[model samples]
Target: MIIEEIYQSYLNFLKEFTAFKSISTDPAFATDIANTARWLQDQLAANGFKTEFITGYDNPLVVGSYIVDPKLKTILIYGHYDVQPPYAKASEGQARMIEEDLWKAEGWENDPFVLTEKNGRLVARGAVDNKGQIALHLTTVFELIKQKKLNYNIKFLIEGNEETGSPNLRHFIEDHADLLSCDSVLISDGEIASGHPVIEVGFRGVINTAITLTTSDRDLHSGLYGGSVPNAARELMKLIEKLYQGTTTIAIDDFYDDVIAPTKEELKNHASFPFSIEHHHRVTGTKKLFSENSLDFYTQTGLRPSIEITGFESGYNGVGFKNAVPHTASAKLNIRIVPNQDPKKTVKQFEAFVKNNTPSYATVTLQLGQGCKPIRINPKSELATKAAKLLTQEFNKKVLYKYCAATIPIVIDFKEILGVSQVLLPFGNEDCNMHGANENFEIDLIKKDIGVAWGLLS
Candidate 1:
C-alpha cells in the first residue's frame, strides 16, 4: 500500500513530465522541449527549490537549488528531460526510418508518452533514461525537506538536449560555474547489472565517423565487368576483413597504445560479479561471443577498445538484384576508446589505417563527427566508498564497480569542467530497454534507489 501510494503520487508527476514529448533532436519538437523545461521548473519551484532557467543554448536548462545551509556540503544532481523521438526520418542521415509502428512490432504494450504500470514496472518513453529517476529523486528530496532531514545542499541541473550529444552543456557549465558549484555530483542515469547494485566508475570515450570508398564514377554492368574490374563491394569487404586480426583484436597499428588495462583489484572485484554467457547469448540473440575463452565480457567491453561497423552499404539490397557493380561504398564507424586515449588522435590513427589499407585503385574519404574523451572516477574516493557501502546494504548484495563501455559526453564535461567527485549510481533495471520502445523502470528498484538517495543525502 505504501509503494502503491508513492507510485501514485510519483506517477502523477511522471505523467506530466512524459506527456511533453521532449525530443530534442527534432526541430518539430522544439516547443515540446521548452514546455518540458518550464514544467520541470514549476515542479521544482513548487517543492520549495529556488528554480531558474539557464539559457543561451539550443535548449533551456532548468536549475533548481535547495540549500539547507551555505556551509553544508553540496551535491548537484544531473538528469535530462529529453526523450528520443518515436521515429527518425531518412533525411536525418539515418539509414532507415525508426517508425513508431516498430514499437508494437517489438512488443511495446503501452503508449510511449503515458506512464503505465504493467507487471510492477512503470513504462513510458523516459521512464528510466531518465525522467523516472528525476521524479524519484524529487520525491526523495521533497520528503527530506518536509521532514527537515536534509544535511546537504541540493542542486538539480536538468538539461533538455542530452540525446543530441549535449552540444552546449560545456558552455552552460562554463557560463554558470559559480551558480552550479558543488562539492560532488549525483547521477542515476544508468542501470544496475544482473539485479545487483553498481557504482559505475568509468565510461569509454567515443569517435563517430564515416568511411567512404569510390572505385568508379558509376555502377558498371556486373555481367561484363565482374571479373575485369574491381568491385567496390568486394574491395570494401577486403578492407573490412583486415580491420580485425582474427575475431578479437583490431588490426590497426597502435590502436591499443593508450588503453589502460584493468587493475588486479578491479579484475578481482569484477570476477566476483555474476555473469552468464548463455544468458548473454539468449538476450542478444547471438550465435556466439568473441574471445569468450580468454576475455571476460566486462573486460572486453569495459577495459578494452573496440570498433563497430554500425552501418554498411555497397550493393543493391532490394527485392531483386540490380545486376551491376556498386561504384561507391560507405560504412559508419563507431569507435570506443578507453581512458588515456585521445578520441581525436585515435580518429586520426584510424583514418591513416583505413587509407593505407585501401587498394591503390580505390579512393577513400573520411567524415568526422565530434569526439568525447573517456572518464574514470575515483572508485576509492571517500564519497564513492560510502555510497557503495550504503547501496550494498540497501540492495543486500555486494555492490559492483562497473566500467561502462558507453559514452556519456556530459559526464566527461562534469569532471573536466566542474572538477568534482561523482557518485555514478544506477537506479534502473538492466532490461529497462533505454532508448528503445516500451522503456520502463521497476517499481521496487525505484523504492530501493530512493532509499539509497536518502541514505547518501542524510
Candidate 2:
C-alpha cells in the first residue's frame, strides 16, 4: 500500500510530462519542445530545486540545482525530455508532410501519452528511454527531502534535443564549465541487460554512412540490356560484398588500427554474463546469427568493430514486380566502433575503401553522419562498488556488470569535456523497447535505481 501510493502519485506527474508530445527533430513540434522544457523547470522549482533555463542553442536546456553544501561532493545528472516520433520509411523521413500523414494515419488507437499499468509496467512514449527513469530519480530525491535527510549537491541537466544528437550540449558545457562542474556524472539513459542490476562500464562508438552507385541515368529493361549493361544493383552489392566479403573482419584499411581489445579481466567478467544466443535470436527475430562460431555474442557485440547494413535499396520493389534494373542503388552502413577508434579517420578510410572497390562502370559517392567515440570505466571502482552493493541488497539478486553494445555519445562528451568519470545506471527493463512503439518502464526496476541513488548519499 505504501509503494502503491508513492507510485500512484508519481504516475500523475509522469502523465503530465508525457502528454507534451515533445518531438525535437521536427520544427512543427517546436512549441511542444519549448513547453516541455518550461514545464520541467516549474516541476523542479516546485520540488525545492533552483531551476533555470539556458539559451542560445537549437533547443533550450533546463538546469536544476539542489546544493546543500559547498564542502560535500557533487553529482551531475543528465537526461533528455525528447521522444522520437512515430516510425517512418527512410524516403519519407525527411519530408514532414509525409511523416505527419503517416503519423496521423497510424490512428494511435491506444493513446500513447496516457500513463497506464499493463502487466505492472508503466507505458508511454518517453516513459523509459528517459522521462520515467529521470522522474524516478526526482521521486527518490523528494523522498529524501521529505524525511529531512537529503544532503550533497545535485545538478540536473535535463535537455530537450538529445534525440536530435544533442546539438547544443557541448557548447553549453564548454560555456558554463564552472557552474556544471562535478565529481561524478550519473546517466540512466540505458537499460538493464536481463533482470539484474548493471553498472555499465563501456559503450561502442558509431559511424553511420551511405554509399550510392550510379551506373546509368535511368532504369534499364532487364530483358533488353541484362547482359550488356552493368547493373547498378549488382555493382553496389559487389562493393558491399568486399566490405566483409569472406570473413567476419571488416576489410577497410586502418579500420581496426585504434581498436582496443578486451583485457583478460574484462574477458573473465564477460564470461559470466547471462547471454544466450537463442534468446538473442528470439528477441531479434532472426533465424541465424553471423560469426557465432568464431565470436561470443558479448565479445562480438561489445568489444569488436562490426559493420551492419542498416538499409539497402537497389532495383524495383513493388507489390507485383518491375522488370528493370534501377539506375542508382545505395546501401546504408552503420559501423559500430570501439574505444580509441576515431570516427573521422574511420570515415576517411571507408571512403578510400569504397572508391577502390567500385568498378569502372559505376561512380560512387558517400554520405556520412555524425560520429560518437566509445567510453570505458572500471566497474570495480569505489563508487561503482557502493552503487552495486546497494542495488543488490535492494533487489536481492546478484548485480551485473556490462559493456553497453550500443552508442551513447554524451558519455564520451562527459569524460572528454568535464574530466569526470561517468557511470550508466539504468532503471528500465531490457524489453522497454526504447525508441520503438509501446515503450514502457518497470516500476520495480526504478525502485532499485532509486536505492542506488540513496546509497550514493549514504
Name the best candidate (by TM-score). Answer: 1
Clashing pairs in 1: none
lDDT of 1 by residue, 365-391 (tens): 888877889988887766788898889
Give the C-alpha miss distance for residue 300 in model 2, angstroms: 1.8
Q: Tell me each candidate's RMSD, in Å, in order.
A: 3.1, 3.3
Tens digit per residue, CA lDDT, model 2, 394-439 = 8777777788888766787788889987767887888887877667
Go through the candidates in order and give the clash count of each: 0, 0
TM-score of 1: 0.89
Model 1 lDDT, residue 423, Cα: 83
